[model samples]
Target: MYYTDRGIEELEGRRGEEEVSFAWLSDRLRTFTDLNPEFETAVDRLATWLARLDDDEDE
Candidate 1:
């Protein structure tokens, strides 16, 4: 499997670390595995979102 069970569990843990809802995490996770063709887009979006939030908090 491209994403092993352990990988999925690890992904869940990473998702929790984000402090966001499971639904949002799940949606974003679609980018990590083989679930979506737009994986890169999802990753870029999350990166941008987190960077913006971090910047705002630092201001």
Candidate 2:
């Protein structure tokens, strides 16, 4: 498994049952980026990808 999968699995194992709103997730992402400015581009890309998940345009 990819290294990132460990964090993903931990997140699922720890909080998979919790339901959260996009607003809350957005706020958290913003906060994370604020604290981790180096990942701003990655976070922006991820947010864009998630926001466009249902779009027909090719990635």
User: Judged by lDDT, which candidate is best?
Assistant: 2
The models' CA-based lDDT, in order, is 0.67, 0.98
lDDT of 2: 0.98
lDDT per residue for candidate 2 within 1-59, as digits (tens), equals 99999999999999999999999999999999999999999999999999998887774
Instruction: Point out the worst 10-residue segment of candidate 2 by lDDT.
Output: 50-59
After superposition, which runs of candidate 2 have C-alpha atoms over 4 Å from their true positions? 57-59
**Clashes by residue pair, model 1:** none
Tens-digit per-residue lDDT, 1-53, candidate 1:
56567877887887757667657765656646456655668666866686578
Clashes of 2: 0
List TM-scores for all candidates, in order: 0.32, 0.92
lDDT of 2 at 22: 97
